[model samples]
Target: MMNDIAKMQELWQEMSSWMTTYMKSFYSPEAAKTAKSHLEIKSAKTIFFDDAQIVDGIILKEKHTWKVVKNCENLAKHLNLNEHDSLLAKMIGLFHDVGRFYQFTVYRTFNDALSENHAKLGLKVIKDLPFMAKLDEEDLATLKFAIGNHNAKEIAPTENQRHLAFAKLIRDADKIDIYRVLKPFLGPTDGTGCSPDFVDLFVAGKQCDYTKMRTQDDRKLVRLMWVYDVYFAWSLKQIVEQNYIEDIINNLVQDEKMMQGITRLRNYIQEKLQTKDIWQG
Candidate 1:
């Protein structure tokens, strides 16, 4: 048993050495400046496509992944992030929903309550990938934290500013694309009004608990409440410029309280749009 354990440890060290040497040659010093051409990004894309192929009728979700990556690139550019940071941001977007493919294939549902939390599943997938070993320790941690929190109600508390910043970036990028994905599904509620608790949350400018969604109107209100959670002015601008807010509002069963929430949201959006986004990172 001791000899077998010694052999296993030796093999593991050899594999780690070979991986280190391979990655040093695979990634150039300038790789971050050309993130799209980076081998790890290519590997991530390959994993995404392979996973996507397992689930048959989710073309929309596949397309949503591409758009979310683009949104992340554009948002990074808007923030004037350096090349290394930009690459990290783009990587976060590319892998943010990596678990969704597996979730849908196995569970046949996108609902986290019905299936599993895609973000947490995504972290497991990421950690298992060999390409992730090429990333610097800090970069790898940031990537995990950002992707882990992408679908979460709120980002988990952290003092690591870089992790928090990248998390916010991925969240905004994901939400921006989500509005487009959900566009076709927006319509009048099924005559069942919004739940009283959900309405109270909306009026208070708070995000609704998605699990508590009891009606179609509750779903619509939840999306509207996402605007309050949006962290960046640039993201808010994209949402408003695309008329996503207006479209949802048009479909909602607008009681006086709903309208009050809408008014507050609109006011907040206008103010956010006028404010310049200065990157402290």
Candidate 2:
């Protein structure tokens, strides 16, 4: 018992340091900057405490879980990964946001700014759990690398080719499912307008020009711009085939600049998918 506790502490300290370094380098500065005021935004605790209340939190959890399952199935088929790799990918996808559960339970907010990076918190959860002990050393390392860095802007520079490949796979799979989650919230909801700070992190390049995204509606357009960060041709093909781009574009406030950006991104992916050998090119 003493040995187990000590080992857990050691692992926590090591992972904590690694997460700090990785976030310092790769965490989205724009997200933190734009949403400074919302850093303390809290989730509705009443929803969690009330027995009779219909909570979006429970619905969101179930929906997110379903999305992860779909991502695992589709990615396994698309990538044609080996059995071990396929399992690793699926497990990583399933557990990637486990931290969010704890974060909301404790802090009552999904906002990482008010709490800690859910990725790091997830690592801690995995480490503390008994199930994680069953994984082989290499599989464990890959999962850690993938879950810890899936939300990062890009893979860490220190990561090797193998780690990078797994990271990219999980990242792509996560983004693909997120489209489903964003569908209900894309446009105006009720009387309360959206907040641009909500998506400032996802805003990147000219497609979501930070300066022009002064309103929540404009920032919502950044969801369509996720294609720019897609790392796999197969993932791009899946997005195109599913018409995720069109769905996002249709819901957004169609402006000339936003449409142009989406069109250019659509063209780029279409051309990439058309290539006979995408991996080589």
Name the candidate that leads on lDDT.
Answer: 1
Provide the lDDT at 266 for model 2.
71
lDDT of 2 at 155: 72
Task: Provide TM-scores for the models.
Answer: 0.80, 0.68
| lDDT of each residue in 204-278, candidate 1, tens digit only | 989877977888888889999999988889999999999999999999888898899999989988998988886
| Model 1: pairs clashing at backbone N, Cα or C within 3 Å | none
At residue 226, what lDDT does model 1 achieve? 98
Tell me each candidate's RMSD, in Å, in order: 10.5, 11.8
Per model, state how many residue pairs clash.
Answer: 0, 0
